[model samples]
Target: MVGGGALVRKPASPVGPLALLHRPVPEPPSSLRRGPLREGAWRSPLRSERTATLLGMWVGVAFAVCFATGLLSHLIQNPPSWFGWPSRPVNLYRVTQGLHVISGFAAIPLLLAKLWTVYPKLFEWPPVRSLLHAIGRLSLLVLVGSAIFQLVTGVLNVARWYVVMPFFFTTAHYWTAWIAIGAILVHVGSKLAIIRIGLSEPAAAEPPAAAVAGGLTRRSFLTAVAATSGVVALTTAGQTVPALSGITVFGQRDPRLGLQGLPVNKSAASAGVLETAVDPTHRITLDGPRPQQLSLAVLRSLPQHTVRLPITCVEGWSATADWTGIRMADLLDMMGLPEDAEVTVESLQESGLYRASVLAPPHSRDPLTLLALRLNGADLHIDHGYPARLIAPNRPGVLQTKWVSRVRAL
Candidate 1:
């Protein structure tokens, strides 16, 4: 019996819902609990402000090299009215483009390490403490995203994986680089004071807990990152530096292997110019003040000049060969065109976008610019532009029109 204020007892059945409800509630696991945000949790013993700052410095240097070299390559491919690239140092384009690729590759690991070092900051509470802070974070996101995009697309281009890209790799990569560099500049400017402090401070010793765990130390981690970058450079630099060819397991092209001991980016068959390129009746039509149609035999009979020049591709592989052909200046002279006249070189590869390229006045006037008939003292390989090709100094290999059919002076 129970009174008005008294509780009534029920038979305890372990399988029943009432019995189960009476059982004590289990506590949550320690890992599932949310502890207060603390410095110790946010900062890894292996990573510190000093470590991040040092990594940032190295990353900055790599970016600087990449930017300068990339700009030079772009200029070589697309010269302005005032810019006159030199032709004497035949390997100038090769060196600059090589540096651009290698520096870009080296930046990968450094960027990853730097990101890891500061990753905890991404989860910082009160994320937008101020307008400036919010802007800084946004800028960082853009910089990181652009940097990754540029690096990935660049690598894909080097590997000749055109299927992966939705747009033209060159145009996308070029514009993205500008955005990435601009974000980097803004970030550095905003964080100048903090960066100075971090860099000036001496590296902290490993915490006791970290030492007891016996994992990678901060110094060891940095060494590993740097070693990774060096390994990447060694494996890819062989495409440009012949000495490293043996160890270049990852190189896209072998400098010593191709139609005439040089790598070929595009073949006659792929370019759809094989028929016309090998046709004996194919003649080069020069359209200028005095329009002229000259057969290959007749063009070959003209004054031939031999020039040793390196063909540097946008992908960064380059090879030097003795090209025998008529000087473009001589051709212009025969046409009675002015010395400052610009010329348009058209290729028999009719379907491609780069089938035609324009030579500025300086390039047209340069004696190194040739309508090449032979390479390396041998008849040009069908794959290497059999009938004729344009070999110009300090120009990207893509701009070197192959299977030449016409040259018009402007």
Candidate 2:
């Protein structure tokens, strides 16, 4: 039998490794049809291709729903700060936006199954198939690829807040997702024929091989991957679920947040940022065209604005903060920071590797731009980017740039 554990196979050709390797893996002989046929819901008798096709299509539908919802949620939560969607109550954006993550997770098994059924047609290549057929097959592959990326980065985002290893999901995840979605659309449009095939066919035409592998087919590998995605979600869920709120495992929670877990600096003491002294001498800075620079005194003295904004992470976790920093725009205004100005931020602790920042002019001008020195109200914690850190409403947590030491606008 082959490594995959299948039926018999023909002998290998003479000469090389194939000849020496007595059928490293054996597949069932072409004549063998070992398993009893399966009956799908759409089959005339629930055993045909119709049933399988229908089931696969429905799974596809579930994936489609998740994709659309998740994308909208992303746009909303990470909107241009001044961004708006439809004429609906803009207040519901966060709630509606949550659907992107939750539902995206739920689509795992469905999308996998949908692909499993259609993928067989994909290898019918080298035959110069119709343009649409080729496009459709390519699309499905890309969708699967994209879905994988989304899950990976989404998981990483959670790891960041959870303080798990291999941090950096905030930046990496955002970039990959854009590529994934384009692939999704191509796969979806090509499936119109498959949907019709499901609706019109009789039973018995379905394929049993199409059943997703585990949980009696109720929960496939896709489900396992995404369902387990909740590890990060669970880490963050302390705030949402009372039962889970206080329980601590290896201390992932922030004692201050009161429940929902917050990421810790793991090396707060070693993080090396001195927050003990809000020394006026330790001035804030904003460097400008021709390297013009100013002290925090100068920044605060220029013009100040305060905003109550939350830093939401892609890991499906969030934290609200009252940020009090100079309006990025006002500071930039001091040096005439360009609309395309790129800024670099530094922390007091020469220890942190972070250093560059970008200021989206007129954009950062919003009242939400804050250089918070406090959290919830009090001075910022040593672990939470103390002394001061840049917080922006227009960006994901990654872009906020903690541990400020310098700001270079170029």
Candidate 3:
């Protein structure tokens, strides 16, 4: 009634609540609308199912290598009752631990590339479309999280940077590996179908216009990723592989740079055993049926035998040097003990988890086991356990028990 136009609109139709709810809403602009699905809809030019599958295959190989080597290292450190790790080929631990670290480093680039290829799927609509899909997605999340954690922590450990971790790195890394491996197994099983399809598809056609204009093809991108992994391995493999030592600027230790052509992880001063290790009053007490306490002079005068063995550390560095000392078997015999007798070697370090270590019958009886007093024809370096150290085949450098104070038969 007030205005002709306003009166006409009310008369045309009484807009009730039901009508208002059912009214046609104006469409948002195309920029704000969800677009129709199309092949290769991901914005990233590098995103492709085939590319992800290829990268995944390489990553799987790297994981397998890392897992096998890591398991061997764990077993070596904490052998079960039934396991018997070999003591020969003295560089066995060096090679395995080196492979473990190098493979892990190499996998970094592959993992990142693989994630980048499939990252778009992370934002897919309706994340939990089905029960199995939900399980798979959850497992993928675990796999990614654990893999990143393990790699980061392992690298930090290699650098001897313990300040970053709140827990023991070795134990936590070992357990998390099992979890990550289990998730990987499940993810592999779940995605077998997709993986096969992606791999079977004829190589992607010339990538989209964006990829062409950007000057990076899928093949070139994968090659770059592989090259990056290779570079990382080359830079660090020298820690174990002697051939690359001269060029491995990024290695944790230069095997030839420590006291007497070998690296020492913990110096005598750091271990707080310097005074005791170099003291003339120091004696190696042998406790057995015929107990004996021998000074350093008497130990050196005894039938000294020389064996070329490598001191391989858990940190993945090793160096072979001429070690001369009384054989453990010989010493056990002199003490009226059986050749296969189990013995505990105690260190003068006073503190640290590895201050004392037990040698299983097999290791104790190994002819290569020695109560070493000399390295490379010279008296043991102060940092190399001045008076005496234990050097045994297939034994971790830490368990070699520097500054030996006592050997007790068990």
Which candidate gets the maximum TM-score versus the true structure?
A: 3
Model 2, TM vs. native: 0.55
- With candidate 3 superimposed using the best TM-score fit, by how many Å does residue 91's alpha carbon deviate from the native? 1.6
Rank order (by TM-score, best first): 3, 1, 2
For residue 185, what is the lDDT in candidate 1? Answer: 86
TM-score pick, better of 1 and 3: 3
Could you tell me which residue pairs clash in candidate 3? none
lDDT of 1 by residue, 61-135 (tens): 888888888877778778776777876566778998888888888888999999999887876654555444566
Superposed Cα deviation of residue 396, candidate 3 (Å): 1.8
Off by over 4 Å in 2: 1-32, 35-99, 112-153, 156-191, 199-281, 289-306, 333-354
What lDDT is reached at residue 260 by model 2? 23
- Candidate 2 local lDDT, residue 25: 35
For model 2, what is the C-alpha lDDT against the true structure?
0.50
After superposition, which runs of candidate 1 have C-alpha atoms over 4 Å from their true positions? 1-39, 130-132, 203-213
